[model samples]
Target chain A: MSQANEFWVVAEYKDGELQEVTLEMLGEARKLADKAGSLVGAVLMGEGVAALADPLAHYGADRVLLLDDALLAQYTTDAYTTALAELIQEQAPSLVLIGATANGKDLAPRLAARLRAGLATNCMTIKLGEGGALQMTRLDYGAQFQRTMVCSSTGTQLATIQPGVIGVGKPDTTRQAELTTVEVKLDPNKIRTKALGYLKPDPEKIDLTEADIIVSGGRGAGGPDRWPAIEELAAALGAAVGGSRVAMDLGLIPWKRMIGISGKSVAPKLYVAAGISGASHHTGGIRGAKLVIAINNDPAAPIFQSADLKVVADLREVLPATAKRLRDMAVSDEQGGQQ
Target chain B: MRIVVCAKHVLDTSIPFEIDEESKGLVEDGLVYILNPADRCAVEEAVRLKERQGSGEVIVMTLGPAPAQEVLRECLTLGADRALHLLDRAFDDSDAYSTGFALAHAIEPLECDLIFCGSQSLDEGCSQVGAVIAESLDLPQVSAVTQLELGATQGSVSLQRKLDRGGREVIECSLPAVLTIEAGINEPRYPSLPMFMEALHKEIQVVDLDALGVRSQEVGRRGALTKHIGLGPIRPRTKITYTPESDIDPIEALRLMMSGQTAPSGQQSGDILKGEPDYLAQQIIRFLQQNGMTPEANV
Candidate 1:
């Protein structure tokens, strides 16, 4: 178990850049590493990954495990899992955390199975338990209940942290890390899946996950007919528009725009819930927000309880006015600067 | 072509759930159970493929108690030709690893050309069962498939997988492969009237650990390498403090909401002209044009 004391984080890369979630994981891993009396390390695998080691070090990784190879460049389940499994056995980190992205979700389980370790997925928080074990708490039964889990056996404790759930810590830009290069042996016959091509989504599309402010509408927003006012407010705030599961279920918005446990998890600085009843299932998605404000006619709505500020007013009356006022304020500010 | 669709009955994710006091787990009381959303998508994809090929049989299989028949019935109603219910009291407490072993055993006798399952069940969302099942059977598997199309040959299929970093990848695999369907693969079809009635009377073959020659010691809670130690409530504190009133009435309310100290600032403020669709549309169109954009043609 002494080998397990070191903290390891898997860094995910996209378009020659480190994904934000990778930084978030490193930020959390730094805390765990400090508590475990060890150093934080990262497993960097992919094409052109050597450039990522410096940024990882800047983000507080004491060491970077670099697996650089063309076969390792593109993510294939068989290839990635085989390589990671071998690394786990060799390094034997006490705690391994992966971002609960699509790749992480796919890879974590296979690695856990190979190591015969316990896994907790989509965890909200992770900390060192008594005796230096990992304690993980995740929303269960659709965010209605929370379950705390720990690895009962020896070896590595594995968890996939949900994106936008943890805070991105301050990176120490002056830190230096040791980059250890390793070779992963791959069997051609074992590689059954092959990547044919990559498709990129349209850049103009709004990704709420990256939005600094989100304007979400619910059933009380009436219908698709009322979306213009909501869009106006979103435009005024330079925010992304989101919808509750009820709105998505009722076809008010596309399911991709739904924000909840089944959908995307977002952690914008400001979150505005309009016409939303504030169901626990839905609130779980926004709990990571720096601030939450709820607007609904029913003052007794459950969402108000979770909100930092509540407006007992109709959304139809308030949204456009707020948009106009914010616009006016922006214009005045610009004019004053010119004067 | 023979297709095997693995399904699991899970608590509907849309509703609030409680933990059962007796079981020390999720409370099933008043909770509606349905075919896991991902699994439904998988079954629907298989049904569509079979329909396209014009000659294939879809078999639905689940490992749970009799109540899980409801999930199998859902698949049958959606056009599965037959169903297999791997029912046994002993299988109740199986973890992902044990579940994988049991499923692999059950799938061995069927000799399926393709096995499909949801990417992950909503309850545990472990996202490992399909891959583990593939490992147990020593077959190739792909997870989180957003799109699937049959290739030039009968035994090959092309797939588009949802990648973690906001992109998709196209992959090709031969037949006798396992594929887990992601959400938004295709809209799952509703059960037809006649199929629903027929599903009620269908004789779903029940298999046990012994029937599949799986040792009792290899499954259930005992075989599970991990167990639940405790559960906790996630309670985030919400403290509200109103701003001091020093402004006029109209802007005062707005100021109160945006003060940051009192309320989180993004809550929906209603459109000023409430309940007037044409007026709202006119306002929206004007706003768009003012911003050098035209209203969407359809809208």
Candidate 2:
């Protein structure tokens, strides 16, 4: 059996703050490093990003490779691909893992092409296989099935793991590791692209992907004017609010809040869909939820077919009542516990 | 100002897909094909550009089987002035690199100032075609364009490109440049009655490798460098284990319920707030006041 020398996890940072997926990848990488009897290295690239090394070390990285440069400050495909390619060529880790975010999706394919390596993307789970190979599982056919793949090539085995798919264990603050800062040479002229300014959406708005619970409204919610009930329910539960593409097309919600094949994929603990007809396009987004509850005025709505719980009633009448009931139950439970 | 919009026919993403046993690829048994949504957007943008210019012509082109004309008709319905279909048996199973090569060769004979294509096809999601076509034809290419403005007198076009960081860059390039339109770049217009009727009689000029003066060996699957080796099924194993709270009483039925091995049964009871309209109205008003909201602010 071939033993891997070093295991590497590409730590993603935005605005000098490490993203949650980076810590999640490090947790998985540490497990693989233990099995291979090798040290785990975390690769951090960006300007003023060296400060993230200590946190990475706390989260199972034995050493952090810091690539600090002005060009690296913003995520341009050219600069990232160039820096990652150079680091892989020099350090030559046995396995590399990245987050399957938008930035990672664009960066991974380009890096794989440049490095001449095979990559499995949007992985839900990854583990060390026999003969020091990496086994990865990702959704295929629009989240219909989970496809497992293994990278057996000699070069770096790359896998882009999806966020919230794996458990991110608590960091071990006691463990301190070495931090090595490296500078990458970048040519500004070769970068055909430039970063214009970022348009940040409202941070107060819930990100559908990270929400533990989601309350979605559909066409049956009457119209765009009736979204307040949906938002109220979502706010009461501290859940993200989502809408069907039909709702988005009708201008009830922004395009970013649409959930379906063309929109964001979500995996929440509880998904409460109100007035949804459950079109296959919209169902794709809620397939990952642990529990699905559907409420619709039509008794024959397709949503009830896949729902774990179904309430055949008018959403206009039922949603407000349901939210009130849940809120009262919560308050009563708090009072009972105190007594 | 002749504009060429390159389109691709892709499997409808709204349906379920199975893997073919023979080729180890997606099975298209019950699949319906459509002009890739982004490419439809591209065709719409090109048609809009032509309408703005009034004298320019917009042509839609695609490389696929003879049946691919259905997709070309869609472009015509969306408002392309003409259609060019490059169909042949040899082009089957071709990768992006070879497809780009064939497209560049086909357009070599046509007089075109600007070329547009979908940023990426949904099936492959490669996003390499526009760049590869640019490299093959030696033309400047901008990808993931969200906005476009053509300057006829200046012989240049300015565009807004979607970058990785949730931002857009405005770039100006000379004419004869290729642009790949991103999804959500524009709302593609549906076919009108007149356009739909006209598209039926519109002739789609079919070109093959022989007619284009290109050797058959220089195109199609044979010219492709990358090949699919094998496909594997994706399976995820979910292990659910539940632990009980330490302070909880250890009764047999309660312990079993807490294990969570079996799914929960029915909904638990909740506070039932029932009353007539007057009582309900008063309760609602009280709740709103407690929440620091007034009746006037309810709307």
Candidate 3:
């Protein structure tokens, strides 16, 4: 079943930085290839993004296939797909991994269709299953259940993993990867979509899907006056702040922090739901979190069902105590370490 | 002008469910279904586009079981001119790739100018069907679309696509393109009483896999490039509501409810605290510490 005996990670380079998911994919690819016996390849596409090859190798790419050109700088569906499809066909790698980010989601399916490959999207986990099959698991149907999928195709297997599902590995800066520069050929006239511009949230905000830890405020947490307590806990825990739909609608938090069925689905290491009743829509987004603790006054809160730890009390009291304890521990640890 | 809106029939996941061990699928007993949320937005967008243009037809389509026709009927009441139901058991358990393959073949003969689909389906959450259809038909596609406006010149459009973290990107695409709509683009209109009654009389065009020249083996389990090999751990989601019967002693039931014994949920229980705030806070810290989430790990 192995055609080229290589696992590829399509590097996502945006805003002049290598996206964190790329490093995660590289790390996961390294682990997979080490166990399965294959070379790990990374594809970096952007003008002057060749510098990213060093970090890709340090994280785990054995070979970096660089596609650097001005035409490939701004992402147009046609330009990126044509360049990537051609490379994958040339290499015929057994597996292709991509980040389930905004542009990556738009690009992977189109590339898979062009290459006649099978693709799994929003995958939470990818590993070699029985008979060395490429097994993938993802949330299904409003996050009601978890369904495992495997590529039964004879063609290349492709998957886009959700951001933050896997953390990055320690970089071995001593490593160096074999770099192969691929000549990009794309006709501007054939590009169907023109990227006019972009609208990004404030730079101070963290993307919920990419955040490793999050503390989300709910309507049950009272009004805007109580939002700061949630933020303080998030700051202590080094987590991003999220807002339930009702809280966002009430203007307790910004729209970008919204998490639920309609907003971004987040996969954090730990999630703290402060005073949230755990509506189905909100729970749908947080299902991917590794650990969840729901603090609310209502014992019958629906959020408790999904939570690993439940505290049925006023968050106004619980949050302050938790944050203070965490901070105290950090300060004591720092003093002890300095001695 | 003709616009094709593709919708999916999915389980009403708000309802509690249990997975069947044998089939590795959901238990179908006493289940209700609804249109995929994003796809409903696609339907609504199609109607709104036609309404703005003043003349055109909205052809809504879906590939599902016979009961899925309910969604199509629902679409008709929302201003869809016709419904195309691709009905056949041969198409069951089809993966995203084969599902798109069958839909592409069925759509080829229609030769519509524009195609609309949900950015992703609620069932599989695969955002690939529209792109696959576009690739099969050699048409351009714009996905995660929030807003679309016709261009000054024909054969072009100005659209805004959704990005991560509430970001949006403006883009331009040519006509005859497949557009996958995002949710929250618009509030779907509710049908008037007159329109609801009129939609009941409209006949849906039901076509089987054979009619579209699609072989049974090319789809479903036979041709699916992917297989749902296993089920992952299901978070036990038993509702907490306890309704007492008339036979039960009222005092006993009340005691059962208050003693934290109502609906034990089969041995699965999280830590429920009912103590002083300071004591509860200590419990929270201990739990976090046991989980290896110490303050030192907060870097």
* Most lDDT-accurate candidate: 3
CA RMSD of all predictions: 9.2, 9.5, 11.6
Q: Candidate 1: deviation at residue B251, Å? A: 27
TM-score of chain A of 1: 0.66
Model 1 over residues A1-339: C-alpha lDDT tens digits? Answer: 254578899999876778777888888888788877788889999866799999999887999999988788888878888899899888888888898887888788777777777778888788787888778887777666777777765888788988766745556679999999988788867877788998764322647776666889888875755667677777876667898998888776788889988888887766778899988789889866765667687877888766655566667666786677667757887799799
Q: Candidate 3, residue A159: CA error in Å?
A: 0.9
Whole-model lDDT values for every prediction: 0.76, 0.72, 0.83
* Model no. 2, DockQ: 0.12
> Order of all candidates by lDDT, from best down to worst?
3, 1, 2
iRMS of candidate 3, Å: 10.1
Instruction: Flag clash pairs in model 3.
Output: none
Shares of reference contacts reproduced by the candidates, in order, are 0.40, 0.07, 0.63
Instruction: Give stretches of model 1 more than 4 Å off.
Output: A1-4, A203-339, B13-16, B20-23, B164-166, B236-299
Q: Candidate 2, residues B157-260: lDDT per residue as tens digits?
A: 87777643344566666668778898887898878899899998887999887876777776776765444444556555453222222233556446445643
How many pairs collide in each candidate, listed in order? Answer: 12, 2, 0
Report how far off residue B91 is in candidate 2 (Å).
5.2
Poorly placed runs, candidate 2 (over 4 Å) = A1-8, A28-41, A60-62, A89-96, A125-137, A146-159, A175-178, A202-339, B1-6, B16-28, B53-66, B81-120, B124-180, B193-234, B237-299
Candidate 2 CAPRI grade? incorrect
lDDT of 3 by residue, B1-299 (tens): 68999888888878887888888877889888998889888989999889999999999888888999999999999889998898889988877777778888888888788999999876678899888888889888898998989977797888999876667899989988999999878889889999899899887999897797977888777867777888756443222232223235778667656755442222125357777877887887887787667657533
TM-score result, candidate 1 = 0.73
How high is the TM-score of chain B in model 3? 0.77
